[model samples]
Target chain A: MPDKTAPDAARRSQRSRQAICEAALSLVGETGYDKLTIEGIAARAGVGKQTIYRWWPSKGAVLLDAFTETMEAGEGTLPDTGDLATDLKAVLRATVDEFNDPAFQAPYRALYVAMVNDSEVSAGFTSKVMEPGTQAYVDRIRAAQDAGEVSEDIDPRLAAELILGPFAQRWLLRSQPLTHEFADSLVDMALTGLRPRNPRA
Target chain B: MPDKTAPDAARRSQRSRQAICEAALSLVGETGYDKLTIEGIAARAGVGKQTIYRWWPSKGAVLLDAFTETMEAGEGTLPDTGDLATDLKAVLRATVDEFNDPAFQAPYRALYVAMVNDSEVSAGFTSKVMEPGTQAYVDRIRAAQDAGEVSEDIDPRLAAELILGPFAQRWLLRSQPLTHEFADSLVDMALTGLRPRNPRA
Candidate 1:
């Protein structure tokens, strides 16, 4: 039989890890990335700074882990209801809502900015967050193509970018408001090209 | 006659301003933004630290001015060769080249990261760089619509985003290569809707 002490210790370590992730997210959201510290995260989580340092190399790694855990816990495949435009719009609209959430804005932007300058941070974010996220959309687009909705000539990965790119750009630049209406427009334009549909054809 | 001394002073000040902007760009390119300092820029430009501080509030502002001047000096309306696809592809391919250029990468990423946390930097960049750049595309799209190549029902601004957004996303996330081939695919997919063209329509 497995040792009872081993199981108990594993549980405690897991609990500590979760608490540290929560604290890192909370502190970055409240004070932003520049002011965040390992000590502050430790104090908030009631763990020693040594514990944090032992588990993670830096505050950026802690935050990346926090975001990755939070995302994975709630991650679901993109919805597919046979109707391509309807499904894509649902996903984009939900994303817009997430981007606008007060709890998500500061911490998300903090990680985003960090990744811009830090190669390690960028690599971690790309592997842990971006790849999985892009894969979901790619799967959805492939399904649509199989259903005879999207053209076979299109690359599903690039098609996914066409659908998702506008929202990312607008959000990053704050060029304009991200509304459900904007999401709908993107889905429509992406599905139906800029060429005027030939009514008589 | 106008005071010759006043004109001479104005010429000297203009020369100093150009030197400072050039120095700021070159230093940021070589050392990256984190190591850049006003004193460094002044020393490189052969000007006093007081001159840099007197003109700009922060390094971010100085960088913004430098970028804006560089872009404006070369700013031209997007080409409208009547073939929308060819024109857009040319513009995007050139952008791909610019993004991949060694000299453009570090300082551009620096300003991009700075704008994430600094609202003042964001506003300055939006007004000075983004707005003018976007407008060029908007004008080209408008011209295309008038020429009957694109659908009149399309919003020039939104359509512009559809074409530009994918490039921005791929570049920022570093998810894939931003090649001329990728630029061509974006134009093709964007021009022809994802739906397979009805051959007998």
Candidate 2:
């Protein structure tokens, strides 16, 4: 336990936690999740193994925390610029850019591999990453509904899925190249739809 | 290599291949992809390790072959019942049913986990599973276009992703409960779109 009277000690503890999380992220990227260990993280962070153990239960927990920290460091919500299509496209294009970046690929893939096999890890990811990210889109859709740009009949949750799911599918499967054009097409197809419009009822 | 003149030897080789694939699938279900090995599959299948080595270079290859065999045992095309929405819903519902089955959960998750981490495994999966499956939907969309049910201006490939991507995302992320209702909603959303229809030109 940290002493409440010692401000310097609390700051040192916070610094140690950040170092450990960063160490875990970089180590997983270098060695992959299968070989990452608490000892390696502690050694790299210049902290004791007991320090890691006191904070996180397992390596998966540490990685989850690391991923969460990265996400929180970004803007916490989806853009709501009044036009749903423009805002969603901008967000998705940025996501495509992130997915295409070599610097982020290894660590993200390692975390995803861990999430696939372990239910506990999967649940942690859902809570920390998926839920909040999805909620931001849902909020944007709701804002569109209020502005009369979107139909009231559309379920905001499902609308969020329609906007976000294609990107996740293409990225996870590596089935095709992820491009800005692809993001724009998803927004267009999702908004206007696949069926031709009839001007006359 | 089996003697071409010996029908009995050829039949025996076919049986051995089947046995090995089955063993690989069941072993992955029991112990997961991380713990699976060629030796374990050979032992479980009652074949020598040399037999497995002769046909496959690694455990990932063996699992890919196993998954391919499973997919081949089913009907090889998406349904084309003239109504694109109905047909897409039917296909997505069956996929959701397969995902929810306890019998299929372990082996499928193992294959997916392998796909995410290894580019070779992922490429095999794309060729063996993802591409063929997406092509089936694309063909049906084209059929719908010819029949005047869909817009010719719409990109068939992106339409397929819009149809299939939601199911893949929910299944992979476990973000929400995947239900038949969700499948139907996706079909509707992908068809009519999110914007309210304007009746007057």
Candidate 3:
């Protein structure tokens, strides 16, 4: 009886958390971030307002949690197949796919707007959201270095930025269409480089 | 006597234009963008409101013109030394310095915010400001390729993105301190790459 009842409670807790996150995400999209509130999320999620206050201190926290949840739910984690090129291409594809989806894009954008508008958000945005997400790439790059699949001279930290920088610019700044072809091209260029042409060749 | 009169007229026109750009840049910084007005700029510049109207279509246009003028005043243009490495480093250094300055930084940020907020601004922002800026790097990279300083297989357009993307990310997103050391490291990594280690080496 204890085993069955305990598992059921755990499942209920998970479902409530999911509903809260989803509610927070959609409300932010429809009404905008500044207008979002704990009461609204509670009403939409069908939970008590106390439930939200127990979980998150502010709307920003809930939204970021949801953002990370959305990324993970759709794409498990960035690939780590020991091959740097294959892993990077997989991650880039997943990222492009996420950005392309309207459901995900809305909350993602709201989170970014807050990050840019508020100094408090900006300071933590990199460490809390950006840095943790980049860790997957950095870890994979480090492993590749050990296997001699990547140059040891390249800083994993900066290398990850090099890999993502073009995509980020196109996605956010240029608002250019991101395709797999573009992703492949970025990986190829950064990995092999436009090595200075051989004078003789 | 005609030559003297014509020279005086041209000088007055040039002085008025200078005053207007300077006034526009400073006003946007202190008052913020949406609150900025043409009449305010005219008053600050000590010129008639019609003078501004004759030269620029909207406040947005005036802001952009002033933004570009500041860049030319300091750096002249993105460098194009015979060597790609030398040219790229020079351009990166200049860009970092411009973003680091408070006067240049303020309107520069407003332009970006507008690009994100308004579709019309977005379309022109990429073409007018971003494309022209990126073009300098592209042209230099193409020249380097012709001179055997850069590999032919590497697309000049993509290569230019690799060079500028890091700086853009750091400037816009990270809002981190911009430094020559960081710029030099970016150039070095993109140029040589963290290529897969030599199995024997």
Candidate 4:
């Protein structure tokens, strides 16, 4: 059994972490990443700046953690119910919904801007957020390959990239609205070749 | 015949425009887009801020012009060699070279960051820059379709999107280096589906 004091401390730590994350995200959103500072986050969260520094290395780190935490709260993981198409579509739909949410939009925009502008921030974001999210998809693709649902020769990493690339491009470029139907069409286009498969042609 | 005075005035105007574009690109490279200003660009280019304002609406516009001008200096059209593989590889290789150029990187990065953070800037970028570049690819794909190089039923827009998506994802995300070999592999993977043509049970 877990120690009783440990659970209480863990809960307290989690609360503090959540408060800090929320403060970081909101501050960055209100002011662009260029204007965001640890001092601003600490002041907003009602915590010492040192407390934030102790928990996070930089404002970018805090923003990444905040974004990840928010995504986790929204049924984050890729679903695996033994059907590749169903699983991919379900997770991608959730992602589209998240992308469309006003609350998620601001921080995501800030983080994306920071990622492109700052090399340190980009490294941190790729490792902390993008890598894990992409890994989940790769894992799903690999599972499908093992089950003979997908071509075994496909490079899982490249396949995951192909699967997610169109949506990411649209979202980041603001080329179009990210919608469930758009996600569905992207998945359909990717799974079946652009050439009509006589099956669906 | 054209009027001699009109030709001379056109030449002078073109020279001034080129100087302003150089100043904007160089200043943004050194100071970044957020710190870049019309005043600084004017001072650096030895022109009045009004001159810049007369030609462009914002710093974003100037940078976009600079980026487009740089891109156009090379093979400005998507290749339509009637062979999809040859055409795509040539274009992708050229793009890889451009993306890897140091002169092109900073201003592109600044514009990309600005696009993500500012909605109006993004829309302007999409219309003025992305749309034309993407259309070039679409035209090439359409040509390939017409020549029986690609499947006629393939959606040109989606096909172009898929081809460009991976490269954009890599460059913007900074997840990996953009290289000619990598571009070649992308073309190969994208054209030939990831699945083996023949699978052994």
Candidate 5:
């Protein structure tokens, strides 16, 4: 779909760009990220490699674009109803669902492979992709802290980590099955917690 | 060092094997894992690639062996004084130190790359290496649950994830500076509490 805000010429450009991203995603799903090439995406999309290079510098960048688009379509804005625990659980449950989806998982695995292999790609993914994605949690945690919902002694940054870190570990590391049960349990443990003595105090 | 428990002939073999493992670590550090080859390790260790191939099926396996050996030397055992909070903190803090160390980080990055690329390597690493390493935590979490230290409602597996997931996230994702303080905070948060209402009840 073209960006509706654009004029006809700009709409055509947007459509072409969207096609290129779709091609990137398709090929990555088919070939895995390591075998995926810019040439292949361009060929699939009926565009030149120069067309892709004109917008994105590397295959990793193109994949990152595709990931962000899919991500927006799936887990866009997190809820903020002033109930921090409920809100966090909802967002994390969505994440569990996303990681379970093959459309997201395969390409994501490829991105991780690319990130660890190339420092430049890693930096781009972190700055352009991850840092922005994390802001929602950071904002929510800060809000909770300010509202006295979360303890003032808690570091919002670390609090955010407590929520998302385990998600990343389970999903990215493939350490265990990503389940809604697991996600809810994380929120449950985080809120009520494991301490016999209320370790927070 | 040779495995002291081995007989004289086996002791000599162990010493030779240790040299090869050391060579694998040194080369992985110097050349990075991608460029590391069995032939290169053999040449450095003054053995044939057949020697490496004899004991381990792949370079990744050899690397895992080296990782396990190094890990045993560094941490020996997680302090298991039956105090879950203290024991978890100590283990996680050591992990922070391990990830921060160049020796572990380089090979671990290599292992992660290898795991993504090869199913066989992934299986071996996950089952043989990760599973065993994580069993300690799983056992401990179960023990805590049985002792009524942790809430009975909590899934020990999920609880284990909650404890180590953040540590893995900070270390593996390269999201933030992994520190002892961060490790302590995770344990503190897990034990003391996060929610005012105690979601578990």
Candidate 6:
């Protein structure tokens, strides 16, 4: 038989984690990352500072978790429909929508700012948030290659970088608006190069 | 004969501008952009806060000027060699060197952080710092198209974005070391798509 105390303990732990994440996001959004403090987050979440420290090493880590959670809630997973074009377009369009959200903007901005200011944060942020998406793209490209849809000589990792790099550049720099049309065009460009072969000669 | 006081006044103004720029860079390097203030810069430069306010709208403006000045001092202009490959490699190599400089890194990183945090700052930062380099690349690509070196169908602006996007992505995220070799490879990959343009069809 299942233990009643086990369920109660699990629920309490889950509630604590949720409260901590919410407090971290709200603090960073209201006050920039540089100004946010662990004590402030603890007070805001009605938990002790030691509780936050027990779960997370730093405020940057907490914020990273919050940001990752928000992205996952929206479009963190790459959809694989067995069609590379359809899947990539679907993912990129979802990314554009996420980037447009106001709730995501401030904390997203703060996370990148934190990365710029701290090298440790940059490494952690890259490994946590960026690597998963990159790996997923690579997997999709490799599958396409195996199916003889993409060129065999192309490096899947680099190819994925090429597809995602332009969007990241524009989004991070605010060089242009990230729209569904822009995502479509990016997919078009990426797939054109990834097509079975090219005849530009 | 011109009044001697006019030349003296011009020299004094130039001196003040130089001092202010230096102070802004130093302060931002010591304390990240978020903590930097107009008052701090003014005090460091031995000028009144109102003097800085009179010339620039905000601390971001001062940092922008400092960054532009640093770029100018290092590589005054983007190369215009007729060959796209040679010219792009030269320009990107110079950029890699600039990014790797200790003096350039902090202020540039600070400005980058500020741009990501504020939309207005992003717009201004792009217009002032990024647009000029992008325009130069566009001109070079246009020249390549006109010379029959590249396909005319390629959008010069988009092509420029493609070439710089990878470097910018890596730099902003601090994902990899920005080296001359990496920059060269990026240029090559962008110019010639991952798939061979003349593969046997």
Top candidate (DockQ):
2
Sorted by DockQ (best first), the order is: 2, 1, 4, 5, 6, 3
| Interface C-alpha RMSD after superposing true interface residues, each candidate, one decimal | 1.3, 1.2, 2.9, 2.3, 2.3, 3.5
Off by over 4 Å in 3: A1-77, A197-201, B1-77, B196-201
Q: Report the lDDT tens digits of candidate 1 across residue range A156-190.
A: 98888998888887988887999999999999998
Q: Which of 1 and 6 is ahead in lDDT? A: 1
The sequence of per-residue lDDT tens digits that candidate 5 reaches over residues B1-201 is: 877565887877898799998998888888865578889999999988898888988787788787667755333235568788888988888788878988778888877777775567777777766767677787888788787788766777767777777787666567678998888888988776665544344
C-alpha DockQ of every model: 0.68, 0.71, 0.34, 0.46, 0.44, 0.40
How good is the docking of model 4, by CAPRI class? acceptable
**DockQ category of candidate 6:** acceptable
Residues B1-201, candidate 6, lDDT per residue (tens digit)? 778998998899889989999999999889877679989999999999998888888787788877777665333245667777888898899889988887888998998877776667778789878888788888778877787766656677777777778777888777778899888777766666644454456
Model 1: lDDT of residue A201: 45
lDDT of 6 by residue, A140-170 (tens): 8888778766777777877787788888888
Query: Clashes in each model (backbone N, CA, C under 3 Å)?
Result: 1, 0, 0, 0, 3, 0
Return the DockQ of model 4. 0.46
Question: Residue A188: error of model 4 in Å?
Answer: 2.1
Question: Candidate 1 on B45-162: residue-level lDDT in tens?
Answer: 9999998898998888888988777774546598777899999999999999999997887778878877775668888988888788888888988898898878878999998899
- Against the true structure, candidate 4 has what lDDT? 0.80
Candidate 4 lDDT over B1-201, as tens digits, reads 767998898998898899999998999989876678989999999999999999988787788787777665434368665678878898889889988887788898999987887777788889878888888888887877776656665788877887788888888888878888778776766665544434564
Assess the local accuracy of residue A38 in candidate 4 as a C-alpha lDDT between 0 and 100: 86
Model 3 Cα lDDT, one tens digit per residue, B47-138: 99999999887777787777777654333246665767777787788778878888777787667655554446667778768887887778
TM-score of each: 0.89, 0.89, 0.74, 0.82, 0.78, 0.83
Model 4 error, position B18 (Å): 3.7
TM-score of 4: 0.82
Off by over 4 Å in 6: A1-17, A30-43, A47-58, A71-77, A80-83, A191-201, B1-14, B34-43, B48-58, B73-81, B196-201
- Least lDDT summed over 10 consecutive residues: which range in candidate 3 chain A? A70-79
Highest TM-score against the true fold, candidate: 2
Per-residue lDDT of candidate 5, residues A109-170 (tens digit): 88877777666777777776677667778788778777768776777777777777778767
Once fitted onto the true fold, the runs of candidate 4 whose alpha carbons sit more than 4 angstroms away are: A1-20, A30-43, A46-62, A73-77, A195-201, B1-17, B37-39, B47-58, B73-76, B199-201
